[model samples]
Target: MMSKSTPLAALAFALSATTALAGDPVTYQLDWLPGGDKAPIYVCVDQGFCADAGLDVTIASGRGSSDAISRLAAGSSDIGMADIGALMAAKAQEGVGVTSVLSVFNKGPHAFYTVKDSGFDSVADVKGKKIATSPFTSSNVYLPLVLQDVGLTEADLELTKADAGALGPMLMTGQVDGIVAWMTDLSRYTGQGKDAGKEIIALPWSAAGLELYSAALNANDAFLAERPEVAARFVAAFKKSIEFCQTNPEEAAQSVVNMVPELEHGDVLGSLNDMLGLVFNDVTEEDGLGVFEPGRLAATWTRVAAAQGLDESAHGAEDFVTRSFQPGGEG
Candidate 1:
């Protein structure tokens, strides 16, 4: 029967259906396997920040920064968290469709690790010494620039390319004098040292005047262009999640563990604490979270372009990033 309440019920149903379809769905790709480094993304999901922002975000684990960027460029992911420097290098090449939306790490984590008793006083000590590194590591892509920064050349060191899993064991067994790795991996080698009764020493390139930006939040061009508002909402939620992680790292680490149940609880917490220090610093303190300094970004682009032999015109840092999506206005 044609009743008035029937029409009202149908109208309400239609509205609910429309609302349900309105939330944007996005795949948030991580640069590597779930760990402390990825706590903020987990926090955003666990705390309902992404849902509150009208986003249906699905988190995906990644192989590495290069692999993450490749997937994003191939249009498999809407957004990605990865090594911004590696992304810059990829954007320099043809057929990539990704851009930076926010900066996650203000400083690069690239460093060389050696045992304290190994007698490496500084980066110079790496000269004429065998240094192990995985070919897939982002440290390999920037090794030339790092060596240059220390006034040394590749010829100065005996380099060995090995699997990441083999690096710590090889170093511990004295197969290599030192290993090139990200600073966050210190906890790993530290644990190994504890098992072997040795002390690990880190020589971060930033301390040696080769400062570069590391992991960043990125979005593919099509999604960023087709749905600007969705991107902004995601950014706001991410910023809130980052703040939560900074304030309550232990809880945030627990959330990450809940997502990646295979991860060790203490290891995840340690890595989360180390990553947080890189996430918040003098620049973030002044500009707010997820903000990047234009000057620093520009300088970083110059160095990266030179290192990768990319055309400056094609790899303009300005085009690779947009500030309108940050928490406040431009950072």
Candidate 2:
């Protein structure tokens, strides 16, 4: 028998099916393992920002910026976070098919961490001191430029490469006068220093004239060409996620922990709080969130070229980035 309620039920089922199929699938690649620095993407998924934007996002972990870029270049990831400097270098060297769409960390994160009372008050104070760094960190390439900025050179200090996990222990035990690390590790190193009965001090390269962009949102060229609307929606949603993290840090931290249950909530919160400064600061205040200011973009390419020994004239800064995906942009 045909009943009136059967038609209503069929209509409701059709609407539900339509709503379920509305979300576009997206693969998000990470430049590094899941952590507080990588919270915005997690927030986007966990806090419904991606869902609200009609995206079904899946995050893929990466070993580093280069790996993340490689995935994007190969079209394995639709969008991801990576160091824009790495992208600039890659574009000049190989013409990788990835374009940075938005700035994440507008300032460089390179810094020197020293135990307080070590007489290393500033970048200049590291002269003739022993510095330990990870062999594979991109910071190594920029070390020469940072040293030159402080009126010093590689010859002025003794440099040693060590495993990344050992850097803090080396500094606490006085094995090295300082360790070359990112500002994102400030809290971790500070806690290590306290346990060793010492205080930690960070000398950021940005404070000493390393005016350049760092981490940024990058998208695959093919993805942007084929699904322009999806790319734009993802970028807008990502910007919203960043804003949400800035306002509700604890909630943001929980979002990451919720997705990556192996990560402790406290550690994620601390790392996220430590990373906020790198994301939102003087540069971000001048240029609104997610913008790649032309002057800073040029400055970033200059620094990258100098660090990687690439010819500056090979490509313009615009070659590595596309602004059309941003809110109010041509897309």
Candidate 3:
């Protein structure tokens, strides 16, 4: 006769069986490297949110919004984050097989970083100053529109493109009066400025009338069509993760550090705190979280069309979004 199993062996077998029947496997793609700005996905996995929603999620690193969108369009990832503006541009140009499901950042992340002593307190003050930016940033495309709103143009300022890593240093050393970067990096840049004995100020283009959506959760068409239930569950869980992050920011930051050990805890926490404003702010308060109001969506497409020189009438903004997968959506 077989001997009775020990308590430990019995518990192990039960846990294994539970995991085996836990959930369907889903792949998540990131628009950029692992950081506090990308904390929600990490929180979902590390905090059992995905598992609770019957999803076994695997995260894939992405180089940028374009890269992430491409991966989703190719069916390599079920859902992930990307810039909604980039999605609009790609859909207008190529008609990619992906659609944004949830708006993560309701407002644009584009901003100008300057040292306080540089006398550049707002976008209007940079007309005659020297500016440095990363050549690859999408912000460069909208710079002219923002400048136009401020009654200036690119010709009014001296612009230089440099590596993203060098932007903070260049500004602190007075090599450039300001640098263009995302609001997500405000904490890191401010810390660097403190190290250099300078005070950093961020001039958000949104305040200067550059209004539009930024990052959002997007899904592959095939994934949504084949397993609509799974998509709905993931979106619901993802929404819960964002709410959790807002209530427990330190824990959310720790979730990223838990998944990516190379990141420092304090740095992750600081960046996560800075990013919360982008996720939950006046826009969120007005329109509710994750809902893409029709007026704002159209405005986003309008800005994108102008920036990329695409025909505004060629495609409607709704073409790039599939709202049925939202938490209380039709799906």
Which regions of candidate 2 are displaced past 4 Å?
1-22
Q: TM-scores for all candidates?
A: 0.91, 0.94, 0.94
Q: Model 1, residue 153: what's the lDDT?
A: 93
For 1-331, candidate 1 gives per-residue lDDT tens digits of: 7988999999999999887765688899988888887899999988888888998889887898888988888889989898877788887776478888999988888889998967796887788999999988767767888788778999999999999899999888888899998877778888897798888888888788777677899988888889888888898899899889889988898889888899988998888877886788876787677776778888788878877788877756776777878766563
Question: Per TM-score, what order, best first?
Answer: 2, 3, 1
Looking at model 3, residue 167 earns an lDDT score of: 96
Q: Which candidate is the best by TM-score?
A: 2
RMSD of 2: 2.5
Looking at candidate 1, what is the lDDT of residue 197? 81
Model 3 C-alpha RMSD vs. true structure (Å) is: 3.4
lDDT of each: 0.84, 0.92, 0.92
lDDT of 3 by residue, 49-98 (tens): 99989899999999999999999989898899999988888888998999
How much is the lDDT of residue 322 in candidate 1?
Answer: 78
> Per-prediction RMSD in angstroms?
2.5, 2.5, 3.4
lDDT of 2 by residue, 188-251 (tens): 8988988999999999999999999999999999998899889989999999999999999999
Clashing pairs in 2: none
